[model samples]
Target: MLRGSAETEAKLRFQQASGPIMAKGVEDTAFYTYQRFIACNEVGGDPDRFGVSVDSFHAYNAHKQLEWPVAMLATSTHDTKRSEDVRARLAVLSEMPDAWTRAVQRWSEMSQTYRKPSVDRSIEYHIYQNLVGAWPIDAERLQRYLEKAMREAKVFSSWTRVDEAYESAVQDFGKGLLTDQRFTADLSAFVDSINRAGEENALAQKLLALTSPGVPDIYQGTETYDYSLTDPDNRRPVDHAAHAALLDEAAKADRKTILNRWNSGLPKLWLVVQALRTRQEFPECFDDRATYEPLPSHGERLITFVRGSKASKKRVLVIATRLRRSGVTDTVVALPEGEWRDALGQRAKVQGTVKLDGLCAGLPVALLTSS
Candidate 1:
């Protein structure tokens, strides 16, 4: 108050304090507190609400296109509780709530022997959700994330006020899961069984992020499937050299080859590279002035839309799947009369009413452009 004035002092104080308060409250504290479904515990996400309708999604995108056309559209980031692909895998759980409930119950029973005093049901539930979301995770990585999560929850343990015993017990219980043969095997079996479905969702998500109304932000290592958690974990460095090699190999690989090897993450990289290239070559289709219209599909399973204007040289069509597999849409969209080519992976051409099965050709999503 001595330097400037009371008003200036108050303004400076608010500016200094507001940033950390909201970040700690919303991004760290509240996100962990409302961990009903751990997948939705992402930054700016709600755990209770499952998902939005196709109509709602289009409306939101339309609004974004009109208002904030150049804003960065990001799915995963440093602040995300879990990476995009992690959420994609966990999303599969929503489709199988009954089985997931039973699995979580059995896992809790199995961990009873190892779980510590402070590791209550709530803690166990959050841990199980992470286990399912980030499968094939190493003991060390999961332990690190578990510690971060426990601290963030601020329930029994936290960063500011250290609770060594509680955190150690939780970490030990998490490590015990790897040692428990039955638990690991069951987790592996279930994760492997539904992996394809998760991949389908991941592909659809990746496509939409890249081709949707706003500019896509491909986080490091997310050009492929990334199952990371928030902060220091998600901040791990990417192997750009290896990714460069995959991009080279993707050119020669056929659609089935890429789709079949989902674990290699080639399909996602392929989609990203192709989509970006299309956006680069035909900038008009994705620019601010471009028109966005939802294409009519028979069912609610498909997210279908096209972008372009009468003045633009090319029109881009984006078809992505949701809540279902690729083969569900054997024949769905009836395109506008023109010569259309799959601008993404798998070079395919068609005109008039086209089967999504043939357009995507067994792939979960498709991006087409008028020639």
Candidate 2:
């Protein structure tokens, strides 16, 4: 910056110089080496902190609403280590650490035959976590990702001094393990066990990203259950036709239909459409002047909040389960007095204090506004 008299030109030069340095050093090196709770190891994220408290979350949102309300509120970006849905799915492990540990141990023993001398436990561990996150990924994709990952870690192999033998063994391990029916079935069963809670986590994550204070940032293919990886992988083609078809389907579908198809990614698409329309319809509620009011929920399992006020004549109430609940508990939240309707356009009215489960119906999330 000091080299050139033109400040703008000098700053650009410095930015260009620093960007690659940061990417090569931190994004490439540190991200690979530090594998403790890898879900938190995303671009612009703290690797140590697994999750945040509702109070802290609310405080951050309130601060944004009061300060930089227009900053992009991103759950997933091209720069992320893993996609949002992938992270959401992986987060279920936090709830069942013992199960996860036992599964990892079993997986390692099952695949011990495939490991070469250079293929270390650390890389194998990383592979297992990533497999759960991006389950149902093809063998080719899995092998490709493994090569990239192992190389990035620079343990047994690296991009510069490529460990061809070790990389080959890792690839063979991926292919072999994938083909091994018993191992695949075991992994699949474990994933299926946590799948429901993962879906709930994904839904909650979706709503929070959309309704949080700041301009909501929607990444490509993220309107659905995107189990994507880092760049080039995340930037892969999205099916706009399918998205449009889902939107058309959502237009005529009833609330029951909306709540039934979490697996189809229709619910996620419905959420995006409704949340965006709400922003467009009620600009005042999301503007810099809008108020952020945190509401209290019974049992505190739900992170409840209202944006905007009566003075604005419109407000958005957002609700999402804070923890994974197996069956709906008798949770309740106090509501603003008026005829409340689903912002997702479900034909239902709510008033006064309402049971949380009844308010959300079958869904783990609720988006409402009042007339």
Candidate 3:
């Protein structure tokens, strides 16, 4: 799997094998095995489950162990089962089984009258029929359908079948009337539920994996938002030219202020650049013996942690927020009672107990370090 562009083959092999093996002094053979097991369990019977739980477990565990100084964590990969947001929302189903079951029933009820079976109509076929025939579809069956769809979508495009890719695409569009309505309604509800549970679990897990003991790796555009989905879609090349243009524009004006005004995605790009700079400047902090401290905030939208090297013991503070808007907040840190600088803004000295008001407003993360 590591040799190929897709990790499916490796993931499958890792799951099928028994026990664990040693790989490059990093016990990954065992880690992969456990991860697959957990992933399978997390989505027992949901079409959108897609093993995100397993991915998260692997990331967190890998970070806990100092073996992989940097670990690449992702819910959406080229071979992922579903889109990241879709899977993230699906994970919420585990929290509200009854709601998930009832929603699936409604979706099936609404989709049963289609002329031709919906595209990729294997399990959904049975689900729709069962819902209409039985009046009330079995929750277990609905769950199974969700699991099957998630797995199958990984190998087959929902809009393309064996010899009927074009035909399926047409049918998909035709069915859009009903499918779109039902899907959007159900998915919106699911997203709302997930947001209520707090969007921090996934984000926090990613950051912990990134800055903790392991080698932190980022999946192309994931630093900004979750774009979970399978290959072709996930593998789509980033528009570096477009991004470069935005960067240039922002740089010409007040980079930070311009970024704050732009609603597109310049802020995210800026944050990624800042994170990269932080990693480059303070290699020692991420190397070993770093401490983690969660700050107290009113909204629970901000996450702050500090890492430092053991030798020089220089500390770098990271302040990350999940809020959609910008605001100020107070954070307490155990720095050496001296002036600290904001690395992203050219070593601007920050007073005691810094206020992160406009630091990363509208941005996903803010990387700060001591001078």
lDDT of each candidate versus the true structure: 0.83, 0.82, 0.46
Off by over 4 Å in 3: 1-67, 70-76, 82-175, 178-210, 220-228, 247-263, 288-302, 322-337, 344-347, 354-364
Judging by TM-score against the true structure, name the best candidate: 1
Quote each prediction's TM-score.
0.93, 0.91, 0.53
Q: Clashes in each model (backbone N, CA, C under 3 Å)?
A: 0, 0, 17
* Model 1, global lDDT: 0.83
Q: Candidate 2 lDDT, tens digit per residue, 1-371?
A: 25656987878888999989887777787788787778887888778878788888899999998889889989888888899999999988988888999999999999978877777777778888888998878897787778778788777789899978888987888888899898999999999998878888898888888888898888888988899887667788998998889889876766788777868888778777777888787788888788899886444467888888546578889999956744556876778877778876554777788787777777778888864
Indicate the TM-score of model 3. Answer: 0.53
TM-score, model 2 to reference: 0.91
Q: What order do candidates take by lDDT, descending?
A: 1, 2, 3
lDDT of 1 by residue, 1-371 (tens): 44668888888999999999988887787777665787877667766677988998999988988998888999988778889998999888888888888898888888888987877778788788888878888898888888888898898888899899998888899999988999999999989977888988998999899888888998889988898887778999999999999989887777778867878989888888888888997788787888888887556788999888657568988898877732475656788779888776566676788777777776778888885
